[model samples]
Target chain A: MEIKENKKDAVLLLELKGRLDASTSPKFQKKILSVIEGGEKNLVIDFSDLDYISSAGLRVLLLGAKKLQSVDGKIVLACLADHVKEVFDIAGFSVIFPFYDATEDAIKSFE
Target chain B: MHPSELIETNLYREKERTLFYGFIWSAVFLLPKTVAVVLSNSVVLLADLLKSISKCIASLASWLSIRRVAKGKDFSYNFGYGKLENLTSLVLAGVLIISLLVIGYEVYHRFLHPEHIHDFGVWFGLLIVAAKFVIDVYFWHHDRHLAKIDNSPIMVSHWKFYRADAIANGVVILSLIISVVFKNISGIKYVDPIGSIIIAGFLLSSAYGIVSKSLYDLLDGTLEESLQLVILRELAAFFDDYKEFHGIRSRRSGSHLFIDIFLEFDNEKKMGEIYQTIEKIRRRIEKSIPGSNVTITPTRIPFV
Candidate 1:
């Protein structure tokens, strides 16, 4: 998991490159939480390079979204491949969350 | 000690510590044992060489177990990965027991047909004793510190094995001394094999004890006596406002606790009060059990 902060738009880009299964989800959560703590209100989780996600990964993402919401912060998913999107839909996460096709669109909507 | 602190802990740190220690010990004991066996044609040296290999395997297993145990909770394993530690402990025990049996069989064969041992066996046995003594003492001191601060029972069990290894090496030195001192005492050469079988039997028992306790914890066995009492006291105090409390059920998973209670509150009371009561009980349990992850289910008492 690679996390990069872009100060230009106050956007924190998280690049998840590998499988986020039960073994690795906690680490993913910790990294995201740190970004949240740094006052990055606009979070762009780039899944373009991500391969797989288990339920544990989904739960961590949900927790992240909930935390950001409490602070009036916005979290958006960018570049969702078809299979990954299916997981979100099956879990009814699609109803609870806002998603976008590209990073530019999610960032623009945040403004 | 603090829930917030536990929540913030990096599950990777302690795991790395376990792996580092296991790897260090494996390299230290295994390298010399293998080299000694080749340099000196000694049966006792060969036996100790086998023991070193077994120790290395146990250490490797401990490393893998540490990684698994450190994982946090998820939908796949709702309770968390703590029980993975217990599973690993059981597996380690099984492996040790199997090694002990194989070693014990060889010892029995050696005893049945006694033979002369190489002179180099004496020098190698002495060096092993010196090395084991230093390592054993170091492990003992560090293990006490780790045991006090960490909740890792498996690590402590491994430390215990190290202590036993030191003792076995001491016995090896004794047998070597007796064999070298007097020609008539060559009869005592049988002691080495006899002692190994005895040591193997002891290792089997210790491993069995560790495996059983780990399995018990994994199965949601009873809590420590003092902790159980504290839970019951808190429950009784929380529900005192109700008419009576019955059928209080509780089970423990790693650090998480789940409790269910049947309450006979006044049927005349408002629903809001019942909700408040349940909420209060939930908070109380959480407070009582430090680092507790709790879920409480309330059942209304049936009217007669």
Candidate 2:
């Protein structure tokens, strides 16, 4: 999976491409956690190009959400493909993350 | 008890019905086969008699165990009566082993002596066995279906038993055909003993299969990895509602799963909201995994 990282206003945006599964989740975890450790608080993960997510990928997302919750910062998700959204819905992870129709809406939530 | 607390599983009733059919079916043939063994000196008839009697006993044990488990879910047994099914299967496995020894001795004797005498009563008994073989196939297929839906130890054990019984009936039929019809062939009489040995082999294999599976279920621990991930997914989805991850404890009783997840809620979170959150988490997990009960406990200390 390719993770494109940049800042949009005060929000740190990570747009992921390819499948975020057991094979790719660890690398995704490293980058996402490191971004948090680098002191970027408000985060948005764009799943527009992401195709699938297994339970392992879900674990990392939880870990990232928990770490952000420890600080007063937050993480929301954005631009999920239809199939990818279904997975989050089935896992009940949809309720845990603020989901947006577009990356701009997710970044706007922080502002 | 509330209706919601009851497990909606066919894990007991389906297996009970399967065993009941087996019991009644074997009971149908038991007397005639016994008579055949008494009247004939044929090794094949003696093997058939042993198999018929053991089927009656094995089916009765399995049937009674399922009946007990089906109706005996009481507060005294915290995890319900699932383990009773395993114990009874172990008992039936013992029956198979004993029958194996008896058949082995009879076949060995026949190997040394090569007795060829047979009576019409034995022929009539062989006809009954052929009918019972059809019933064996029915139960084999029926138990196989139930085992697929309810992968409980009892159902699986019964499925294996019926499958072996069906094939063994076929072997017994082959031996009867050889002794009753092909006795004039030069070396045909010995095939009767060999057929009994083959039937004994099936019984041994079935016994081994049941013992290994029942023992494993008896010793199984914790929820599997995929199930654990499911619990984690729900927790992650509702991450804001609670504090620390703490831990999850889970185990299976019969076909039911019991899971307890430990989480710390914010001190100031209202009692009503915490209750709602707990209900939401519990309901989602239970919905995702059928025949499962999930409890979310709010606490300050971590408990796994």
Candidate 3:
């Protein structure tokens, strides 16, 4: 998994791609943990190109969200592919992490 | 994180099933031989059969121990069940030693009574020893292959058991050969019991080694000094900016290593860069420590 980070308007935009299973989830977790510990405050995860995710992947997201919340920051998932979106919905993660259709909307919400 | 808490992976279910099959085969080979010896009322054959029966039980225990040891860390076991594997090794060693002692005592009784054994009893004992030798060799090779690929202590112990079985069988064959060579010698009948005593001594020493080592690990003794120095040096070398360290602790269960260290860095380092440094160090430490769980903590200390 590759995390491409961009900063604009005091919000961090992270592009995520590839399958997030047990083998790859740790890398994703480390990336997200680094982002949270870096004090980015607002995190916008763009999942437009992500293909699949397992329950372990979901645990990483939850772990990241908890870390972000500890610092009074918010984690938003944007551009969820339909299948990824379904997984989030099924897991009730959509209720825990606010989702947006585009990175621009998530950034605007942060503002 | 506690050492056991970091154990996230385990052997697959297929491996567990294979161990079960191996244990069953071992028992199958021992039962008929044991029954034959008891029916014939031959002390030599009876004692050998009893030893095989104990080996069968220890084999079953080995299977159970592997299953239990491969389990992930639970709330009751903060560091995982790796120690269970060590305990199993000790249990196996203890069982082998106890069997040897019992057989030794029986052999001593036979030495006092001096009874003549039938030719069929001798032939049956020889056949069983030959069969057991072949099986033990097969198991040893299989266990060695698995241990090479997986680095499992349980597999290593199993391999050692096979080696020990081969030695015991060789003793049996040697004693039989001696009886044939000295058929006219009046005092030659005591060779089998004397061989039993020697084999018992061999088992006692090996058991002491296994039990002592496992007990030390169960008590959380420091790992090999060289391994500790190598890990510490690897961390320092991988992260050049890390000037000092403290709270370095490590313990090993089976082949897996659990390492905890507090890495000192310059106080003014940005948290992001610091985290990146720590991440890199964690990766390097893991690479250096095979099958390792590494936790690196960033701490600020004066440059010295």
Best by DockQ: 2
lDDT per model, in order? 0.65, 0.78, 0.70
What is candidate 1's lDDT per residue for B1-304, written digit by digit as tens? 6876564354346644765686577667777776665654445555666666666776777777666555454568865466666676777787777777777777767877876555675677668657876786677666655544544556657667677776767766776666656536647667656656656655777687778777778877755544544554454355335554334445555434555555555678798997888788778767876545545444454212
Candidate 1: DockQ?
A: 0.01
Candidate 3 DockQ vs. native:
0.01
Q: Per DockQ, what order, best first?
A: 2, 3, 1
Note the DockQ of each predicted structure.
0.01, 0.21, 0.01
Residue-wise lDDT of candidate 3 within B191-235, one digit each (tens)?
Answer: 767767666665676677777877777787766544554564554
Give per-residue lDDT, candidate 3, residue B211.
79
lDDT of 1 by residue, A1-111 (tens): 554455446777676787877678778878877888888787888788778776557656755665576577767888888988887665556755678898788777777
Q: Please report, as a value between 0 and 1, the fraction of native contacts recovered by candidate 1.
A: 0.00
| Residue pairs of candidate 2 with colliding backbone atoms | none
Better of 2 and 3 by TM-score: 2
| Candidate number with greatest TM-score | 2
Off by over 4 Å in 3: A1-111, B1-15, B39-47, B69-76, B300-304
Interface RMSD of each: 17.2, 3.0, 17.4
Question: Which DockQ-derived CAPRI band holds candidate 3?
Answer: incorrect
